[model samples]
Target: MRAASVLEADEGRLPVVASEPQSASGLATRLELLRNTLRPTPHVPLAMEGMNLFAKLEYVNPVGSIKDRAAYWILKRAAERGEIRDETTVIESSSGNFAAALAAFTRLVGLRFIPVIDPNISGAYESFLRRICPTVVKVEKRDDTGGFLKTRLQMVKHLCATTPNAYWTNQYGNLDAVEAHYELTAAEICADFESLDSVFIGVSTAGTIAGVSRRLKERYPKVRIIAVDTEGSVIFGGTPRKRHIPGVGSSIVPQLLSHAKIDDVVSIHESDTVEACRALLRTHGLFVGGSSGTAFAAIKRYASRMAVSNRPTVLFLCADRGTAYLDTVFDPAWATRLE
Candidate 1:
């Protein structure tokens, strides 16, 4: 599809160009439009007994996830550095949200997107990618740790080496992903609250917590930065096991996490993740993704141990909406299996 046609199909939501040129300058203009589309997501108060808790509504982004920030920033920075041209195909290994975000933004600039995913990707995300992306590579083979991440990364490497004009965004180790959250996500949080006592962040590629923790520490040095990981995730030195939650944790420890100054780590089981998600929907009417539920679970765990007098202000990111998880997290059958 032509860039002009794609922009039109967007229903005049993005900035328009009369003629779609495939030049570097043209790509920059399209990147600028993508950047302009990002707005500061709001933080709403979540009622707890003692703590002043708030959840950052990152699911409201253009592609409905916090990954939108990193995906756009990585692509925009790549364009500025002359790493990607109009003919370049953007490739990445993602479970769901990142791939969806990349597919959406790359289509706007007329670039082909190939997402190297695995079976763990949610049905909603897989269907979405199959519809929008030019190619979706699903690696069925699991690696030594019985996880698909290593196998997916291997496929990404193979695709990048074989395909001409292909660029791997490499979200796992990309500092641009860190910078995106540091500059945009954390900056927005800082602007919203003058003082924060604690922040809970979910770990996957580790970009979000790494960037956010560094930035928040610089602003509120005493603020506790808690890294939330799933029970099976190896990101925080846990034993590797099968994890059903798509975006909550990781099998491999992301290099980006090495840059973070984490205060503590909270590992939650998939059952707790499901419970937290259901509770958020039932109590607060917030339908959030698995990772957000994981973070919320960590928040509750942390708060329960706190002294009665310490009713500190806390914030956790609601990474994405729960519509994508209806079949898994919200299903009674699935919840029973987790138990």
Candidate 2:
């Protein structure tokens, strides 16, 4: 009944009672530990005007952020399918969380990892990747979209083709990324909430929202799926512009986005994201990242403007911790300079 023991039990298996039967079925692989070491994040509830709110604290995952779910699952499946071996090098393009998650697990399995990122990668993220991943590729040139995303993917393709034993995780276009969230993240949400009215999720690679929406809509056909994006992001038909926030928006539309299922798409500004992050810390005692704040800000607008049933339950996926954005999102000077 001790707190530490209870937490350990939660980490080791699903949050079931000790009397319930659970088995240690498989050999403890590094990927298994990385993916399964933490329990499903808590759905912390809060009272709101038109609905009940729950923040799914995804930052508590092993490597921080919901990307851990996709990264671990992608690598594990690739290894199982004989696409990757112990000596094989894993290559992927990422701005931050996905690469960091991959670096952590690949280091555990003794595989070389190269994270192809852009020049705009944050200091905190770059330093974290450097400490964990030895070979980090920085793509300096921007593509036709005036964003480095296309350029990064081009580098990934080149590396995968030329490097021996190299495999590209291709997170942006990978169906496995969506599959991972469908099986793990969506399942966790359904397990926690029997009848979810709506879910507010950010779209970057679009895997999380696409996977979760597909699974939930399969069961609860009426569940509302709302996508949270930034002003400059082209995901929801906005014109691409200079966006300073890393986690919230993407210059190019992701292949995994499901346009039909998304009932509403809200775009929040960088200032709104900053305010929401500060407000969350001040009011809810949650120090979350920009993507989370973007979702939060969008949810506020949704709750206020959109007509809805009284007291419906809404969920927000808090993607990562504010600690990762201390140099930017949480810093007044840096945020001011960006503005």
Candidate 3:
């Protein structure tokens, strides 16, 4: 059955897919179970004076990151559209969270996944992907901006052209990535909070912020959509430099970002990102990823400028777990170098 036939789209809400239990054996049954097992992550309140702050604990998702939502939705939609067959191989270029997500989901649905990764990938993520995937492609060359994203994309294209029945997920340009957040992640936030003054989102491929900002603006017209980017990222037109953090910045601006309704852009330094990560662990006991720390630092800076009487109710996404950063952000020596 075609996805269009099985899923009904609503004007202002998520598309409803068929939820009936499948009696068929093998892949079909597993897909149904996977869909059924997917649940919304929680939003926990953070103690702060004047303004009500809450962090959406997206790290609790099956693959331990927000990318799981996008990975599942993209593959599911592709299968419905007849793009994924039993012999098809799914390919994507990612350094960390997204790569791990696609690996887990594709394996679950009986599809072969090959991640074109770079040397900058964290040890934890590299170990996980190598264990599950038969072949992991590594690109050693860097692009003009000294990042491997462009080089990785070139490898992805080459692999797709040479490999039979290869389907590239194309997370950077894929509308499915944006829709996943709009329909699932942002929808959850809107349902939880009737009113929000602003939302701080960390930018990478810009999928999460683009989708969440658009949806939140539709629900709360006046809510400020803040796009938090790293200093070296060119996403918001900043000069490109070497960025140490994996998921917080991008050398190339994502196409999905054009669809967002951004009110302001805040550029954060790597130093601040490290400090914020430690601060969250020390103060709130929330051990989140580098991007989450960047968002938190941006929120604190943004809030400092606001009048005390009008402190806004703030919401930020904790994109992934910090355990992957044990060798970097959570390391005192590593963090000290950034200082």
Candidate 4:
């Protein structure tokens, strides 16, 4: 272990896949569960009565979220680059899940972590991060610019400037996050579903749309990739998604999104997302985080549009627990925003 540390010291940053799990077997189980849940099925019958739909159950992942894959990739890549070390302090600005995932990944690497949080983040998620990581910084939403990455980017800018020996796993711009999905998510889906028709994904940093879409398209040349965004999202709406689902959709067109192969963009209303979230909890008992709801609402719309009995359709579910949105989508007072 000391020799490996010395090798990393000389290497600058480890190449990729550097962080090792404390229990390889446990990580193996987590990976298998992730694959089983996220892995696309060949032709599962549509759960909805009339529509032909098969949703990839990402909400079934252990972390109760889909961003865990990105979290795993980003942290692992940084270690490969030797960007993160035992004495290194990691920092990231997040609304919730990303921060939580970062804390978990850092804990695995035995690194000091400092999560820069926004006021919009859920208290449950914030408290959980505090317990997992050694340091946490709360940045008020005083200058909160709803979705243009204003609040988060600003907080990260501050941390990077002041903190020493700190590494920012800049997920927003990192290609590794997308590659993680390309190598894992996309390939697994294609291997199972040979005749995939269309893929539906919610856009945020647009990595999910970009990576998985590109991979699926490469495999299923005739496949249609529909990128979904909230009505206020900047991807196609050309404005910030000012709503509470801060993690997905943005004011700026994410660089990761490849506009050409992107076939089309679907904009779902905030109200629909709330409804879908409630439905997931009631029917499937999947208490997902907010981003998954956004994707779910979009795919449900797509299913209705096809209105077919056997059209192949796939949707990405971003997470599993509403624990992150207890005060927002789950609370009656706050949910009234949808009403």
Per-candidate TM equals 0.94, 0.88, 0.90, 0.81
lDDT of 4 by residue, 237-280 (tens): 56544666656677666667753268877887777778887887
Quick one: how many clashes does candidate 4 have?
15
**TM match of model 2 to true structure:** 0.88
Error of 3 at 112 (Å): 0.3
- Per-residue accuracy of model 1 over 1-339 as CA lDDT, tens digit each: 253644332432333223355777678768888877899999999889888899999999999999999999999999988898888888999999999999888877778789999998888899888877657899999998888999999999999999999999999999999999999999999999999998999999999998899999999989899999999889989889888888878889899989998989999999999999999999999999999999999988888765537778989999999999999999989888873
Candidate 2 residues 7-67, lDDT tens each? 1122222221111111222212445666656578888986667888999999989889899
Model 3: lDDT to the true structure: 0.86
Clashing pairs in 2: none
* Per-model tally of clashing residue pairs: 0, 0, 0, 15
RMSD of 4: 6.8
Model 3, 80-127: lDDT tens per residue?
Answer: 666776667889999999999988877666577899999989998998
lDDT of each: 0.89, 0.81, 0.86, 0.66
- Look at candidate 2 and tell me the lDDT of residue 261: 68
Off by over 4 Å in 2: 1-30, 307-309
151 Cα displacement, candidate 4 (Å): 2.6
